[model samples]
Target: MKLLFCVYLSVLFFSLFSCQNDKRVENENSLSIQREKSKLVVEYRILSNVKYLEDRNCIEKLASCKNPKAEVRFLFPKNISELGLDTAYQEDSYFIHQLGVFNKPIFNEDENYRIYVMTFDYMVSLVVFEDKRTKNRTFTITGKAKGIFWINSSYWIVGNDCHMGCSMSIERIKDPKLLKPTKEQNLDSLRKQLQRLPYEEKMKIVRQEGDELLFSANDTLYNGIGKKLSGFIPYQNSMILVFEQYKSNKYRFIQVNEDKSVEHIDSLVNGKFDTRQFSEDDMITILPKNQSLISLCQTIFKIENDTLFVYSLR
Candidate 1:
């Protein structure tokens, strides 16, 4: 009877502890959700559709078309027009895709700054555009880079070099003038360390060590969501990761907060959309002014027949 009483007491103690732990986790999750909901008050609106057509003379694809021509009828918001895009813009030699998507515009966290990749045959350059509302300045980085990421308040470039296989470099404002290039002393060691990190997806650096190395944010995101990560958008202190369901047309937009809490933001069902073709930055445009108001715009493009239709989701 004494041994039975001891076992019963032990079971009671374990059950109580387990319930308390469960409540703690539940409270934490509830707090995270409340915090997220307060800040992420997104207002959705649909803008007018803009259309573009392929040139009748060009026989090849738009990428190869040297003289790509399209009748451009762009209708954008006033803030987008503030970026110096003329609403009545018409194309003679270059199409809309050639200027925007083809060139590749990589936007930073706040969207105040952007880097445009300019490729001319064998030569490639990065054009950095800084918008201060009053004064807009542009600078150029003359080189080829496999990938460029705005990591830890600095632009890290994975340079493509055939000599040493490849190299890494950092560009930051040194004297408050312009972005200056800084070379790492130990390239081989840094490369080796980065290679050792267990990265399941490409270019999604979720983890970071010191000032240079970066790793995946969450391992569970890789295994739980899908085998492939479409892309991610960095918003404030959280990251909105996109993943397509396996063997399905559905896409999941997941938000991972700073406290490591995961939440599902939204989902999209489109058969023609493929994340592999474009980066998240390319697909979505977040303006700085609208972000402060908790009102931002998302643009989605669809091509039917030979005409391109651009839809704005605000």
Candidate 2:
């Protein structure tokens, strides 16, 4: 009888302890969780497209249609009142995707600038806005796409034009290979386009390319315009490359000799090579501007479809 009584007491005590543990667990479960709101307000965002590239970013080929869009975004917080960024916005259209600040202010504004490459696909640019505000601003370069970015601190483009193809990977600017330009592919396309145009239009594009190849605001002649250039002059002296800023109605050719003296020929029409009426065909071959010198002081030129047989005497 004593043993049975002890056993019953132990069982009753153990049950009470188990009940208390269960009640403690229930109380903990009933407690509410404390939460804190995030203080980040996105200021703006940028987006772009990416395409598959090969041949060291030189040769371009369509890889069964695997091109996708990529993006670089700028995020700002809400607390800065003097900087009136009222909202953030994003939109996707058939050809482009637009991302920017939306007026729905959420978190405290931050002055710190952050850039993110938010997409996995190879990033490419359909078109880039020449934002004057960002022209002088410097950006710290980081992330997977190093030299792949189109814009520099001074707003110079250091990547492929995407005309031929762009390398999915890019080396740091310090590398010698950086900014070499996939010239064969890019220039070939440009050359073909220029050939179909009239003489005046061709000159215009050449000048435009000169401006595009500028390294900085003050650079003079780092342009790729000279790529198609060759020596000219049917006489003893070699003919130097010439140029004219393309306009709707007029153009000029510049020739230089060993002495660095400039000879501005007005038109390919024997004398007034640079100055011509808009109506004239100017069947001038502007590129491959070469002249053959058969003898000392005697050079031969096939000009304007042999309409002008130019000869030189020393």
Q: Write candidate 1's Cα lDDT for 246-287 as tens digits.
A: 667555555545444666653453442333322222222222
Model 2: number of clashes? 29
Off by over 4 Å in 2: 1-235, 240-242, 266-290, 293-314
Candidate 2: 10-residue stretch with minimal lDDT = 278-287
In candidate 1 the C-alpha lDDT for residue 304 amounts to 30
lDDT digits (tens) for residues 49-99 of candidate 2: 211111112111222233332222211112211233221321111011122
lDDT of 2 at 280: 18
Best candidate (score: TM-score)? 1
List TM-score per model, in order. 0.34, 0.17
